[model samples]
Target: MRLPFTHSKQEPANTRTARKLCWDSRDEYFRCLDRIGVLNPNDPTQKSKINANCANEDAKFDENCATSWISYFKEKRVVDFKRARALEEVNRNVENNQQAKGSQE
Candidate 1:
């Protein structure tokens, strides 16, 4: 499930090192997920797949990031992936349109 992205001024892990740790763990976990083609970490249907494939990285990610940030980061990853796919589609369409125009000239 995707959560709406939000910007919060109050971050519990405000230190640079803590933020880095969270990001590192998150990246590792997401890499594992990507390998298994799992998008939503919180999805109950994907829990077994995640546990079997990414238990170690998932555990580290949970340990490093705050409880609030865990869900936020997972949801944000899905949202970001979808956004990037949409952007790519838009770019492809624009390129196709330009090519068509050029061919007509």
Candidate 2:
């Protein structure tokens, strides 16, 4: 599932970073699906129906890849949140120090 590209200027930095990471993660699945020659069962060209009992190796691997992508984003979100928070804290400390120095002078 290819996500639509957004060109909105008002989007936040964290959002853009998360989106890029998610897209990159999803791309791995797309690449694996292509390599495995797995076609969507709904496609008109796919005459062989994939049944629940009939386990398709490619399909199973694709599902695993999807799960990996989800996990990547989950970890990425936590890291991004921490990073943004750390930056905010550093900036606040710097501002406070500058204010203190000005008051001392």
Winner by lDDT:
1
**What is the per-residue lDDT of model 1 for residues 1-105, given as tens digits with 9 covering 90 to 100?**
434446542344558999999899999999999999998898899999999999999988888887789989988988998999999999999999999999999
With candidate 2 superimposed using the best TM-score fit, by how many Å does residue 102's alpha carbon deviate from the native? 0.7
* Candidate 2 C-alpha lDDT tens digits along 1-105: 445446432222345666565466455543443454643423445334333322354343334334445555445545766799999999999999999999999
lDDT of candidate 1 at residue 69, scale 0 to 100:
92
Question: Clashing residue pairs in candidate 2, if any?
Answer: none
Model 1 TM: 0.84
Which regions of candidate 2 deviate over 4 angstroms?
A: 1-65
Error of 2 at 77 (Å): 0.5
Cα-based lDDT for every prediction: 0.87, 0.51
Q: How close to the true structure is residue 30 of candidate 1, measured as C-alpha lDDT?
A: 96
